[model samples]
Target: MGIVKAAMAEEESKRQTAVEILMKVGFLDHCEHHEEIIFTVGGDEEVTGAYKYGNANWTAYQGSFKDRKDMTDHIKQESENSDYANDGCEICRSMFEKD
Candidate 1:
């Protein structure tokens, strides 16, 4: 079991490094599943990007932005097109319905 433990430790180390890099780039929320990490960029209030890290690399899984304006435009468009009834949690659906 020593070899298995060592491999697990190495993977944990890699995950920590990836988390550090993501945090530096403004990704504050993350979910880990096996070898993959999914990140929500620019905080929970407004996610400017969605990224994934695995196999020692980072990928912009959702969309890429050229600048702050581009990011803002994308967020605005997404908000306008969002179907909260179908997409969001119960609380979010209630909040959107109340708006």
Candidate 2:
């Protein structure tokens, strides 16, 4: 019972961390499921990005920013406050690396 409880707690923690990362990046609304979560990104009410996370995988199919610099800046600033700031999703590991 204790072991099962511990695993459940860990899963919840990971889910929360995923939410925190998405929220910091401007994802205010999301759809969650047992196997995955999805979020739509908007800039000036225009759809900019489509993001999905599943089983530890994070994927960004599109991005809307002034430029690469702008995107990087936004990500860097928001991630600074998260516990996973230094440990981004595998797909984003390169984009969110420490400065």
Candidate 3:
């Protein structure tokens, strides 16, 4: 594979691992929005996990069960952060924005 394709595959692998961890910890549902795949654990609209892609890098933020709300809030805030938004890659944007 080409270097860029390889990198994307690696990033996807990282995101899949994060999803498994979050699901194991009770994050039951997930949806793609902008540059993030947001996972929810329970009744709250808060996030239990976030898989973020920007600048050709992927970042996984997982919330602890005991402090899930805070983590979710942080994820939400980070998603809207100017730095992240400005650095987002077009490929990542196209992949996630379809839904």
Candidate 4:
């Protein structure tokens, strides 16, 4: 393949890997919006909110996970000191309540 084609292919591979990691970490539901695949946390759109994974913003989210293990570890760390109720984030409260 040409240089540009090879580079595009590699980026696409990384994007697919990121999607798999997110889904394995409980972000199973996703939707396409404005050329981006927005994955909802905990499979709920209204509760846990969503993360945009696409060409434009992939770099930001991609760095957070080297693999599925890393992605899950990040979630565990975030939940360790999470203050859903006291923080006044209704979505967070609802998400925790569902657990």
Span of ten consecutive residues with least summed lDDT in model 1: 54-63
TM-score of 4: 0.34
Error of 3 at 88 (Å): 28
Number of the predicted model whose lDDT against the real structure is largest: 4
Which tens-of-lDDT digit does each residue in 1-99 have in candidate 2?
699997787555544553554564464334332123334343322212212222123333112333444343444443332443222243344445753
Each prediction's total of clashing residue pairs, residues at least 3 apart in sequence or on different chains, is: 0, 0, 0, 0
Cα lDDT for residue 54, candidate 2: 21
Q: Per-residue CA lDDT of candidate 3, range 7-73, in tens?
A: 7876555445544443444433334334254434332222323422211122333322223444444
The candidate 4 region of ten consecutive residues with least summed lDDT is 78-87
Model 2 earns a TM-score of: 0.31
The lDDT per prediction is: 0.40, 0.39, 0.41, 0.44
* Cα-lDDT of candidate 4: 0.44
lDDT of 3: 0.41
- 1-99 in candidate 4: lDDT tens per residue? 999998787656654554554454555334332223333445333223223332234455556446544444444333332332132344455767999
Candidate 4 at 28: error in angstroms? 3.9
Error of 1 at 26 (Å): 0.6
